[model samples]
Target: MIKETFSKNTRINKKVCLTTDFVIAGGGLAGVCAAITAARAGTKVILVQDRPVLGGNASSEVRIWALGATSHMGNNNRWSREGGVIDEIMLENLKTNKDGNPLYFDAILLDKVSAEQNITLLLNTAAYQVNKSLDTKIDSIDAFCSQNSTHYTISAPLFCDATGDGLVGFNAGASFRIGAESREEFGELLASEDESNQILGHTLFFYSKKVDHAVTYKAPSFAYSHEEIGANPRSKNIHGHDSGVKFWWVEYGGIRDTIYETEEIKWELWKIVYGIWDYIKNSGQFEDVDNLTLEWVGTVPGKRESRRFNGEYMLKQQDVVEQTNFYDAISFGGWAIDIHPSEGIYSEKPACSQFHSKGVYQIPYRCFVSKDIDNLYFAGRNISATHMAYGSTRVMITCAHGGQAVGEAAAMCKDLSVSPKDLLEKELIHQLQQRLNRFGHGIPGVALDKSANKVSFANIFASSELVLKNYESCGDYVSLAQSAAQLIPLKKGNAPIVSINIIAERDTEIVCQLRTSEKPENYTPDIINKTISLPVHAGKQTIEFDFTDVDVIDQYGFVCFLANQYIQLEISTQLVSGTMSVFNKVHKAVSNSGRQEAPANSGIEEFEFWTPERRPKGQNLAVSFDPPLPAFSKDNVVNGHLRPWLNSNAWVSDYADTQPTLKITWQEKVELSEITLFFDTDYDHALETVLMQHPESEMPYCVKSYRIRTAEGKLLADVNNNYQTVNTLTLDSSITSQELIIELDHPSSDVPAALFEIQVR
Candidate 1:
């Protein structure tokens, strides 16, 4: 028997009360990651998802593929493990299914949360109201689900608002701001001279499939007319043609209100999309319309801007540009400034010209916890950030990293039974860094070494002479040698190493001498010289000079010279180069150290050792290198491709030309041992071929291959046949300096061949 209470004319349905150690609001990437992280850390977690599934923007509703920081396709890199729960879900999907579909995403998310013993998930739940104590702490939240006509009262020690909208914070009376701030506030260059409430617009993404034949579309009423839409003012008119076409450019509703206008803008965008398609088809743009169809229409709109909560520290544009490394950094972001215009329905090009920075910058922990609220943490776009700052950190992967940070912070709170503010101390930050490092999260930056008093140059070349130079004027000597060499700066705590890159045909001999201007009379053996011969063929040559033995004096400097040459150098003072060629040529002089950092300058001539020769009209020359390889046998291939119910498709191939060859340089003598062959999964209808070879060995050998496959006859793995479904093979370390060749068998016609990752370790 359930009782309903009527307050005046309103009726409220009562439900069971659930308690947990941590309660996370919003089921988006940030919330889900936070919940999973907290649960994994041995805390009882309650995850309240507003939707039926877990992933927010990346879910089936939005249908955006999960992308990490790495550029490798299909998981070839090891650095893509930022989201632990996301990776687990992907692994499960790859194991059980072969088709890359949206439905599988939902299933995986549900399975992951439901299977976890420490997490309790409540789907189809929306947080409508919050109850706080007199002390300004969140006590409980009241959630409503219309489908069941029920009200849920959730109580937890720590509350996390993973909602991109910062709904929980707004409702809890937490102070926040909207729109762009003036540049004077944060000393940011990208900030608008005048403050404006206008921000970036939201997007309703859709996917269209291309048919075998072309289709035509008819123009709609809202379609930009020739008179209405013309050349944009920001961009140059190329060949007297207007480049403004309504694609992702059509943006609006950021001025009046970011959240309230999102739905209206979404509806308008949908009309534009379908209406444009209709115009294209009917307007005789193409022929054959039978196969053209819409593949997916995003129900969840991608939001670009929203409320930003005030925190202990506000990340500004200056911090990003200056590459400020904070001691309390918890995450890193590398996306460039992607600002949008305020007036047009679609966004205009960014006003400021600069895009990327010197490198990736760090996000501090103080940005995660709120300044006014206690026991409340925020992640994702809702964190403390200026409008310009959010323009870069609002990407999905960056949000995931923020979510991971908050998740770990929540676990620490539960363990210490203290508020997030109390944990902002220095020692705890170091502990957080250590834990994150263990899980492959790179810290902002740390000094490795600092002393310059004991610097000595070793491994000097025999053909060069050493000369004494004024120690305090190292920069002057570096500028003089700009045409052929450059000196890299060392951080306050960094052990300095000098690297020379050969660029020209000259067999250049370089002499380096270290001296102190303060004590000219005291001559110390702190000098070294190196003369390296340029290779006959143009190629890069690297020479490293270790400075571990020199007795460096205060105000010491070093001088470098091109032996028997007198060439002037041109120097430039720019931190980074605009293009790849210039960037590779410009070396990072100073490491990230808290000291009198060197000025950004480039005076030395950048050297290169490799130069290509012009070939005759029709002549082609082929060059190859052969190195010692390893051997393989049956014992190494313990698991065959025909056993234990292989999950997906399997096959083999022996493409001698395509097979990966091994080039080994043995450092010491060793014995031979059995080799092991790893195989890829049969999931996603992927088939692979494996191969092995001894490379013309006369030793009497008995080779045997085994098959470990599923009961359904799908190939699992094979070692002796030199065929493996997996991407990596580990040869026994005992097999030293032996050349082994391996190949894969051709996959079946029905299955597509694919490989993800390979590693010898």
Candidate 2:
């Protein structure tokens, strides 16, 4: 047994040997993600949670959807690149639940940390005191648990305060600012003209759920009336469910006052919320939702503003709008300038429009480390930024990114035995970029110049690996079919030029052209390209002309090509018939077909087939299943134990039935790699098993052994095959030889048996 002593003033407890290299306070999205990231990088991490669970504001406690860089509620296009620990959590969530709702978010968070070998989670622990070295470096933190009234002293090389409230930073003697800044401070349009300590308000969200039966609820005694809220009619009566009412406009006081004191404000907001619901129910506005019942009422207020730590760098409003690319940027924010009134329940315009940035902007790593205290990093809304800037970066998604960056940086600091400020070196930044890239996090784009002999291209998007093709060229335009067009022009004086402007929505790619129209019969040595990869929003991009030596000019025309999605293209110049020729490499057909190859030797069976038993009528069901079969476990699998099993190539039988009728219900879902079918081929082959096999192209393929048996004492055909001779199966429905069968020789139950093997390809 371990004996511990406690100190009164500092709340220091008997030496509690810290097991983590970094202790991250506040289990909000930022803190949780940071812990996960650091732990994944082979760093021991301790994540302290004030609440019982993780995801502070966006958790079920506050009940808000986790938004991404895009404005859409569930939009994850931009976050695809923000993999690593965050991605692993999301992937796990997708595996268990497809809805992406709050019900499973906690599990996702827990699983992510719990699975990390180096992460220690201490929930219901709040950091209340700090011990620092003479030079103001964070030596240790004293966390207290209210339930047990026990204190824990945790010492770490690096510390991160992901607490949006900046609780740890405040206790550690770190300098921090709160409330709105003067216009002169950050030059933000929404900044208070006069220096004032006003800040954005907090909210307590309540949600309704639809049950099988009708139910109604009345307002609590603590609830207040609309008149008590004192907001304007427009402000108080905004649409709730439809417009997704966020009553942030109702706010009060700042860091100087305890937000707990504003219980009356929350009470008033609740009353207003219920009053609107009652009016809708009684006024007969919509009867369909009469069954709508209150599902949850957030206890932890969704705070939009809080203490801002003073760090090496303070992100200003000008930095955000100017799209300033910081040398030490650790994260990016795309949220708009969203601020709520501080005095009244509502204001004329709670959110300002003038200071809003047009696109995603960078936030530096220095903003995460405290200026006064060494070995301390801050994340989330507590980062070193003026109140106006925090208003925009306070969104949960942006905070998640911040958390990921800090987590990585903190881990790096421990490994190097240095502070976060010192680890912000060029080489360290490169390592961070590499780690983030592996997990799909976005880094600043590296601009590439056009080469004389090669048309090399690079990804110019914020943090994506997508590269550009056919960026510079001049040529005569020719139409491919009717929708696609190309231009082939010879090198001119200094630079041969062909410019094309295309407009497209996010994720849409179109075909482009650069060909010699002079050779209408044979457009040899022509270069046909495709449009640059568009982002999540609609935008336009220009391709300039750079021709060094080639000389060929012909009719230049443009045509839109058939693509996965529809997009409009407009050309400033019309196509004209002409003839000019120079030396150039012929453009070959670019086949995205490379991404759609058939699973090597693998077959898919019963892929997403649904029946009345699997899914009944009038009931919505989400289901996912993976076939059970042993494959060459050694080399076939990538990361997990069931590697070779994933190599099985399974295809759904088209003739079998695509959709399930009354007797058979099936929904054609996404394509699968492979599937397996179990059946009794004959008395001798009682347990006939079909192994849908696919080659593991990314890794070398291998096979262990094959087993076949029956319930009784009978041995089925047990044949061990090598990975070298694995047969390939095509997905084409016309070919019925897709299924490979394992036949048992005898009629004994043991003879006709299930087959298993480890297959590597």
Candidate 3:
């Protein structure tokens, strides 16, 4: 039994000694992800969040939208997202908090921590005191809960400092750098010419909502009008129409110590917020929104940079631009080498400067592990990165991924009874990458394991699936046949044909004639199933066709497009990503050399892709299936590729199906306890932008209601109204079965049923 003493300040005077495998400080997305990852790997963890809620900057008090590999869609990151735990959290946000309500977001973060059995979350607790051993290891951490003034002494084998400001790192006397380094230090073109402490400043934001009645405002004494603020380019972009993220330029305190002068900076920012609202509401400059009222304003400032710990490697700008392939890579960052003016909102020039990379660059495992301290590991904004590199890696989602990598590394350390650096030295890094892949994380050059499913892995490249396939350009398309026809691979037989997607330009009806290739060599449509005419529209849209009206029985491969002029197909570029095409005789492709593949189908009408130089890759239609198995070109579900749609991706069931059921079977009986399901929550949608009100929920094809059963027809687990992108279901008792059936009774939205991966492990 533990004894406690009450103090006059309503604090517990007793010494609370607790032990855990991993102790994580900070409650932001990064810290949250670290705790979640370690706990999920079968370890006891104590997560300390300084604030009353989780999600540090993303919390209700400081509402900065999370950004990462996608770079808020501004960096041209075609289908990239921070995979693994961050993907799970983001998808959950897309499903429930479509409006990006900070309050609901706070709940989501809290619920995730609470749902995990091994995580003991300490909200409103600050880890202020640290005890370091003489051997340069973190022995224990002391945290103070201000609400009750209770002190906790937590001892753990490993400590993760995810505190965005690196509080624990500083407290533990870790080697860290303060601000920008000279260009000579790293050879970064964008690096400051001289050594300086000019770091990215803290920012504050406010939300505005229009009320039914006219709303009025009373400006504070320090409020400054737009004209008075003068010469700030960010002012032009600031309007009632803009969301909070747009006001990231409302920042200050870069010249001062970020940790020491935070309060002073926040006070100045408060005046800016009220002043900006006064300009928008009181000043007659902008039109409309006379009834607009300030919904909420942040009291605490959202910090950008502070003390970055020194590790084995300090990532530089060239590494990102050149797409450096680090051997010890644990994660990848696609966000550009972004930099901001030190003067923040007051700067006369542009607020930010962004430079994109040809592709995502790797984040090495050495960056997070301490160079000197054996047990001290840190992630998030404080991880080892040059100031220029930190600009891109500091986004919340990227930090979250970093946290996950650090947490997983910590768990591995606990298991091996070795330090993080020693584990890497032991050449156990591949195990980490494999585990990251298994968790659905996309580490470039790392592929998902296909041996578990035993099914042959076949599909298009990663760049095939368009991120946002909407009423807009539903990704790119390529005419595989050039007589204006295309082919889609059929994954399995006896699977009823539900519908096929065709492209059109105008609101005219066109006939979609389906025909199976004869002799497995003729690429031309040999057996015509049925000619169904459907009305087509401008931009890319789907045209549905059913096979029940036709007579051909066995299995047929490929579908040809037949329409008058005006419709065009979209496909990926050939110079970078190569695609394969099927033609009747002489094959034509998107190529400069007029390159053609050996004729597989001979003696038929002309078949050509036209451009031989173009890779002819990821160029396919969004088709649907009944008794749905998987599409041939894009086998999102069955195929082992389980990251975002950046790679040719996704398994969609089309608009015709209301509820879809999936059945998984193996060659032999296997013990089954856990079932993981990754849903299609529409990666094409954007979330980190300055939202106008709360936007509509992302159109996700999630299984709203589901049930799991065994081969013996016994109900293993039944879940109704499921809303998770990564749905994990466990049975009461371990069952040995060769087959498992999943019935998706309802969908979260009006979209098709899609699954990234249904990992049996």
* TM-scores for the candidates: 0.58, 0.58, 0.74
Worst 10 residues of 1 by lDDT: 575-584
lDDT of each: 0.49, 0.49, 0.67
Per-residue accuracy of model 1 over 253-296 as CA lDDT, tens digit each:
57657677777777766665454445434434345544565555
70 Cα displacement, candidate 2 (Å): 1.6
| lDDT score at residue 223, model 3, on the 0-100 scale | 76
What's the true lDDT of residue 570 in model 2? Answer: 39
Query: Would you give me the overall lDDT of model 2?
Result: 0.49
Which sections of candidate 3 miss by over 4 Å?
1-14, 225-227, 231-234, 240-243, 425-427, 451-639, 644-668, 689-698, 703-710, 715-720, 740-754
Instruction: Give me the runs in candidate 2 sitting further than 4 Å from their true place.
Output: 1-19, 73-81, 211-216, 226-265, 282-289, 350-356, 446-761
The parts of candidate 1 lying over 4 Å away from their true place are 1-11, 65-100, 212-250, 285-290, 344-354, 446-761
Top candidate by lDDT: 3
Per-residue lDDT of 457-567 in model 3, one digit per residue for the tens?
222222123222222224565443343333433333342454544466667665566665443322224456566676777666666666554544333344445536666
Model 2 C-alpha lDDT per residue in residues 683-719, reported as the tens digit of each score: 0000000011111211011222333222232333344
Query: Which 10 residues in a row give candidate 2 its minimum summed lDDT?
Result: 681-690
